[model samples]
Target: MTMQHPAFAKGHVAVVTGAASGIGLAAAREFARLGLCVVLADLEGDRLEAACQEVRALAAGGEADVVAIATDVSRPDQVESLERAVIQRFGRVHILMNNAGIQPGSSLFGPQANWDSVLAVNLMGVIYGTRTFGPNMMSHKDPALIINTGSKQGITTPPGDPAYNVSKAGVKAFTEALQHELRNTQGCRVTAHLLIPGFVYTALTANGRTEKPAGAWTPEQTVEFMMRSIERGDFYILCPDNDVDRATDERRIAWAAGDIIENRPPLSRWHPDHADAARDFIAKRD
Candidate 1:
């Protein structure tokens, strides 16, 4: 399905980080289909080239434009290079998607490298993308958008990878502040949005799976939901999986916040004392 945005017309440029795979790649294809010039950026050079070729092939008979750039989103220099490349090719960027992320499984008190790597890509990458392209979009009078990919793990604080959770949590908070500031900024046409995806089957979670799991959605499905959210001018593009719904997500987030609100022990959901309570809460909410 095509994304229906009045502001996103032919000749508009879109920059998507992590475009080599998953939601970023899906979004890139969608943007290209909508006649937007798409710049696909990723650290994997071969995959980035292949993804760009796919986009170009899809746009062969259309007016859509596509390009690929190898970039390490964790580094400011690489992000800057991507920005310059887009400006040189498309003149200006209309959509900036900070979607590059990595999940390094680690406990709360585990190795520091896990925390550093996850934060660098998931959190710092979003900050760099916004800092690099946001100002340019602000200078233009045309409408622009910034989409940051966050995860439900960040909001609900599930007990698996604390590094990934913290990084995505930072993304959620940062995107919120970005939207607030952008709306208040004088003459700023660029708008910020937070993309919260449910369980999506992608390379990040492939693990040699031949087909998508029953509870997980494909990247394309997630992007379709995201597009609908964008058309509705939603700030928090919270997605729902086949096994989960909006009500479930809301209750999970509320429960997480309650841990702090009620001054419960850390990770109350995993606490032996609160295990039964958490299970009952989830079951009742579901």
Candidate 2:
């Protein structure tokens, strides 16, 4: 199948969740730069406004359009309101970026609230966004895309933050399933993509960091990579950072797969006896 261009036409509408900061904000800005009508949605009202203003300023003297909506992605009512706001403002949505997420670092047997909140936003948010906007995009004959932001932690199943990991894992699985179903649908024009980003310093990880770490990539860089992947018709938009390359990421992911394929203990990569083997596996030249 031929891949579509990354450029958003002058009147096309793009909806982005978690647009207050990080990759979501970067994508919104890039969409506006491409002359698309951009809808920025986030839980933080002030930050959302600021991001929308920045996008508008960047589009000044251009035909790009921008709107900001304060939304809690976990709440179905709020997500519905976001869709209404977008349609009321732009008449149609051509792109949907399911990027709203939160990382609550709690163990599997830890507090229930953390798991609830993380799953509600990370997993349910993507579900709601797709369910709400997917049919509209499908009815339109024009090309449309749904980008779901997942995580490397989700695919690798690391030791810490089981709640966050599970939520992202669900996103990965759901996006893949959604894409398969969409491709098989007789007249569907909507496509789904899983965006797996590597270590990037953002508000989610801003507990005490004053400067970006060496291994991290900027939100702009991540968005740039995402746009390129979309143009390439990549369903799994796995991104690498300053410290890790695609090869390293592939090895890590393969090791994770081996855990299940070989029926080892959960997260055997972090097991004391398996540490050396895991390291060797990750460092092995292909």
Candidate 3:
């Protein structure tokens, strides 16, 4: 597994948001294993400390460095502070993973707080993190990577949890525009990537469950998949878990596109009238 970018090499730095656990922590650990200096930020202080320790342990004795910060990604000042602190410590940042997210339940007429919280953290956090770190990365001579964590729901626009879907959809659009912008900018070496993860066994998705369901991939597995995707220079790093394959995901996304192209109802796959048809569509072997 050779590193595709210098960011993955020793002495470079990688910052991961929501790194206290799950995919973020797994990414940080993997970076440490690659000997990159890793900085972790999360809203949970104690868990962030534990994660920092875990990343430290992953390194061969004195092989890499880890920094931890208690950060609320939704706030601009906090995210800015995180960037400044990382720069102050490591001198430069070569990789930025805006992976912070929250999933409080929401509905069509749910409490206003749910929607507000979801948008602020899930959408605005990625926006702010990208804005803060992107320019600095572009200024440097090193090749840089920016990975914004998106969701499959963003593309498919599922029926349940409208707020979550909306937020992730924003991420998808923003990352697309970001990659385009970077590509057109002269002397810009930074590449933007959208990581659409499949069902992963993480705290946000656990819903108080003690065991990982069969369909879910571990956080480490997800990050490993992400690395491979990055190496391929893929803009949309869509992941498939145990329950779904790439072909299934492709069919589902094409059907979602058909909702507008073919004049079907929005999110028709989940609608009652379209259930059988959607099932039949999914059942197609080809």
Candidate 4:
């Protein structure tokens, strides 16, 4: 599919973290197919190398235009090294996808290590990638992008996994602030986008399931929706899955915010007192 965004132009450079699998791999594949010099950054291993080869096969310029850098985005030093390596190889980067994340099932009183790892990879990773690469991308004077992957749980602040919710919420807030800064920076052509995926059938979401659930979307479908949103100049690329549509997502988010506005109990949708009201509000139309 041809991309309409100037940032996706042929021969441009795109760096996608977590490119070894799922949405990151899907985005890298699309970029390579569009003739962009694609850099796949992930942990050092055979899986990363294999993903690089898959992207390379679809690259318009073949192997030369596709490279994989062993990177642990959670480490600031490693993320910095990734930026330097990409710059040295490609000279300039037109797209940066800070898409590395992890959700190892967190509880309110879970091991602190779980919280630490989740925040390190899901939130700080995005900050490191954007801050490390933003200046270089702006200096090139070309339309560029920084896409941060977030989650719906962040918006709604659901129960069951507090650490993952907190991490993704930080991503959403950080990406918003980053975009505001980019738009206000003089002579800067780079833009930031928040990609909120819903029920994507990835290794991160599979939870040992061999087959995708009926309600989940494939990584390719989510990436395709993200590209379309970017082409339309949307900052919040909120995606829908087989079980939900845009309208449902909107209502759910609104109900979440209304908890504060109406002075209701937190997560009132799940609270027995407000359950009927929440259901009716979501089912109602304007």
Best by TM-score: 4
lDDT of each: 0.88, 0.88, 0.90, 0.95
lDDT digits (tens) for residues 45-77 of candidate 1: 688888998888776334348888888999999
Off by over 4 Å in 2: 1-7, 60-64
Writing each residue's lDDT as its tens digit, candidate 3 over 51-94 gives 99999988754434887888899999999999888888788899
The clash numbers for all candidates, in the given order, read 0, 0, 0, 0
Candidate 3 wrongly placed segments (more than 4 Å): 1-3, 60-64
TM-score of each: 0.94, 0.95, 0.96, 0.98
* Top-scoring candidate (lDDT): 4
- Estimate, for each residue in 1-286, the C-alpha lDDT of model 2 and write its tens digit: 5454643666788999999899999998898878788888998668888888898876643434787888999999999998988888777888999999998579878899999999999999999999999888888767889999999989997887989988999999999999999999998878899999987889887668989998899999999999888888899999999999999999998998998888877788899878789999999996
If ranked by TM-score, best first, what sequence of candidates would result?
4, 3, 2, 1
Please identify which of the two predictions, 2 or 3, would achieve the higher TM-score against the true structure.
Answer: 3
Task: For model 2, state the Cα shift of residue 161 in Å.
Answer: 0.3
Alpha-carbon deviation at 39 in model 4, angstroms: 0.5
- Which TM-score value belongs to model 1? 0.94
Candidate 4's TM-score reads 0.98
What ranges in model 1 sit over 4 Å off?
1-3, 60-64
RMSD in Å for all candidates: 2.2, 2.0, 1.5, 1.3
